[model samples]
Target: MTERATTSQPTPFATRQLHPAGSADVPWWRDAVIYQIYPRSWADADGDGIGDLPGITSRLEHLRDLGVDAVWLSPFYRSPQRDAGYDVSDHRDVDPLFGTLADADALIARAHELALRIIVDIVPNHSSSDHPWFQEALAAAPGSPERDRYMFRDGLGEDGSLPPTDWLANFGGGAWTRVTEPDGTPGQWYLHLFDPSQPDFNWDNSEVRADFETTLRFWLDRGVDGFRVDVAHGLVKDPTFPNFGKHPGGLMEVTHEAPYWDQDGVHEIYRSWRTLLDSYGVPERIMCAEAWVAPADRLARYVREDEYHQAFNFDFLETPWQAQPLRAVIERSLASNDSVGAPATWVLSNHDVLRHASRFGLPVGAPRPNGIGADDPQPDAELGLRRARAATTLMLALPGGAYVYQGEELGLPEHTSLPAEARQDPTFARTGGLELGRDGCRVPIPWTKGGASLGFNDTGAAWLPQPTSYADLAVDEQTGVEGSTLELYRALLTIRRERRLGLAALAEVEGLGDDVLGYLATGPDGRQTLVVANLSSTPIALPEGAQVLVASGELVDGQVPADTCVWAQVD
Candidate 1:
């Protein structure tokens, strides 16, 4: 426990008002560079071998020095760790592994003191089955009000033995799991879009709706600036459930067409939430949706004026390192958000995906699996790191907000060869080795070069083992090294803020090869920041009369080399 000390009103940490290309005034969030802190792997204080609130508080200076306007913390609420804290059993409090309620209050106060706005993860699509509401649903009768909080339906078999639907969990296995009645007879089934320990909440229930509102206010009152709404499009399912009737559904959101995702009804909920956020007024709170819909236009709906403030631009992240497709995704994402009067947000990696460095190095023609297991072919480390740095330059040069995952600045690659015994992701456990799990990306980040846990904790212990390779990429090792990814990122952020480049209007520039990507970010004062990326093997000519601000690699005379990106100031 700790004191939540009040501090003098801090400088604008979250956002700064800006108008680009004659557009509406944009809030600070639109131009902010937000760092995503995965608490479990960030920094372990208290020698518990797990990252906690105090650890994050101690590291606030790292974020401030990195020039991030805000920090988006992944879920750390009380849970069974079924989905690595996404399956919240208690949304109002912190889990003991992370810290206490007083610790959270102190963390928020510290963030404010360091001039960093806080955006916390809010999982509304589901709750841990161990949650009180779900527990009550299990003990109550079929028609009881307790059952209404979650998706519960009667089985169709003669003895009601079969599942209510054939839908499969996103993590694998049947979506519906049946429970036994109090008297030991067969019982109804409950839906879990994820792991069995996580039950999908019924958004149709008024109580469920009101309960999330309470959770939102609880964090906002504690001084959190906003929220990253998890699975934002997966709420408000189709009432007909038509897709599930004739067949057992096992479709992934490969096309974003799943019945459980992107329903029109979800918009109303966000609109109501926007209203709630508006009432808070000062320091202007915001909400971002982790919606995984295809087509930029559809994703734009989540950020409409009356709905959420921003939605993660994931299409760009999944796009291959090809210039044409990458350019298209960036253009489409910005255009779509512009249509909604909202700015787009860019991200290269997160807790769930392969690090871009490794992902970029995979064989261009090989299969792109979610997780790369031990037996998978090793990526071209040199090539991948080069492209990753180039990609980072392109990402930061584009208009709108950006998210930097923990350790990304250090150029930390995913530890793809983790021993099976060290894996803890529920997907890995449930799939029974059929699919490699996200444990690779979730490995605790290395802070220092030496120590059993890479200086993550005082006692050198960790939930996930750090690879020997991590020593070279540890924060301490990369911090001041010239041409290091960490230094590259710091320079990028400094330039981004000093030039207001994040709020610049992006437009295509001519004269680059088809395999090259070129765009100009026009500042409000008419100066331009031109970004040219050479995705091609051959060199590409840079714009004449431009002054280079920074580049991912050394330039050869006036040409941008293959797998290199440059930011230049132009008239």
Candidate 2:
């Protein structure tokens, strides 16, 4: 394992003498600022129009300088490219489209050398339809061991033509797809909660469990610090094959009593994985769940002491931008995670969701569409960026680990006007364009202001076309520019690190007003930091004698402007 190092460079905020750190007492992830890199869009070194392992390695300095403690990489494993690499064809190999296994090793080594831990995505819930095991299952007879590895069952109708249950796929269409036997006769159907190209695994099968263990150790031995579990809540489904009753085109209406998601059996799998992680010894391996589970209490189960280390707080992400609703979700998230002795993880924008900047730009209570098209109503770009910065400031000041999506530091907004023909997400094809899908948010990151791909590759090639406006948001353009979103993030992260805000911190939610969200966080050293956001249309007064540390926007007359967030050191 690589040793951690302190940088000699000056921080944007006044650096403080923080309390001595204790690695054993508090794991690095507890208060970590982990950045998410959608590998396909991060950078393209070989210039094949797709981002790859070597490409990510070349850009490590960007993240290191951005003040992130670690990076959570999306999958680059061997795949058929169905569902954008979420469908794994070979769990142990890197896709040629990405790079060789050697490249992955080099990326991990280089990341560790920079004192940045690497957390890879582990999709245990399903494998690609083209996976070797799935191919074997296709040739095997019904009830065969190969078929037993997945959820294959007889259909409901007399002709065995209908799906076994009335479950709907999260992407679109029925959850089950009937397959033709090797003899050319229609056979049992297989269950897939997502796209049909991705088949769900039978977790009750010991072989499935054993294979995942091998996959985990493969990456662990390769020096990966941890994993971000995909579909973390949907692995173990009920054996009875119960119907969901209704078909929703989006995320399933899963509840604690739901047959598939958030099942009690899922915890058993996580507990076992936790044991495997512990077996790795010092500089502990961790797992973060991307589970979209229910109420705060239910979501907390995934992070119980013996289970996963962290679970994404989707409830917090789904909450509206209003002060009261945001505070309510924050309070519940903290209380629930605290119950399980785990730190709540906060996130604003990720690959799958609409970018928070654009989301906030919409009128309050407007529909949160998955994708934006040229004909769709446009978001107020200036308003969206302002609110996004403020929202991030508030998120970083809270008492836990925080996630920053790849281009979030640059205040990148979703490519709302992405043409339909340029979209590739399965949801778009499955829904026949009713839903624009996630392609808008997955555009390649712009590094330099001028190029065909805006400096994403030396050859100026990109898989997804970047917006013309990206020139203004390019990293080089904003790197040291005062009042730029990138600089503001640097300042906030610097303050957060110096104060050790994520470690041994206690937060007391202050009832400022219906339009203001305020909290006071006390670090272990007894230093108090007050975070306040004026989400209303009117400015709000800051606490008297509060030493301003960072503000998302300028303060007017000693008061925080509307749609602004401020972090101040208080007595």
RMSD to the true structure for each prediction, in A, is 7.5, 5.7
- Model 2 residue runs over 4 Å out of place are 1-25, 248-254, 509-511
Task: For candidate 2, report its TM-score.
Answer: 0.95
lDDT of 1 by residue, 1-571 (tens): 0122121222111111222353335578878899999999998888887899989888889889888999999988999887789999999989999999999999999999999999999999999988999999989999899998998898887878878667778777888899887777889898888889999999999999998999999998889999999988788777766445322222223434666778889999999999999999977899999988877888898889899888888888888888888877876787788888888889999998888888889986465666777798887878988999999999998878889898888888888888889888887877897777788888888878988888888898888888788899988898888898888999999988877887775666645768888777766555667788999999877756778999998888778899999999775
* Cα error of candidate 2 at position 344, Å: 0.5
Error of 2 at 8 (Å): 30
lDDT for each residue of candidate 2 in 153-255, tens digit (9 for 90 to 100): 9998789988899988888788999999999999999999889999999999999999999999999999999999998988989888788865533342255
* Model 1 spans with C-alpha error above 4 angstroms: 1-25, 244-256, 365-367
Report the Cα lDDT for residue 122, model 2: 93
Report the lDDT of model 1 for residue 40.
94
CA lDDT, candidate 2, residue 282: 83
Pick by lDDT: which candidate is best?
2
Q: Which ten residues in a row have the lowest lDDT in candidate 1?
A: 5-14
Query: Which pairs clash in the backbone of model 1?
Result: 15-28, 16-28, 166-248, 166-249
> Mind sharing the TM-score for model 1?
0.94
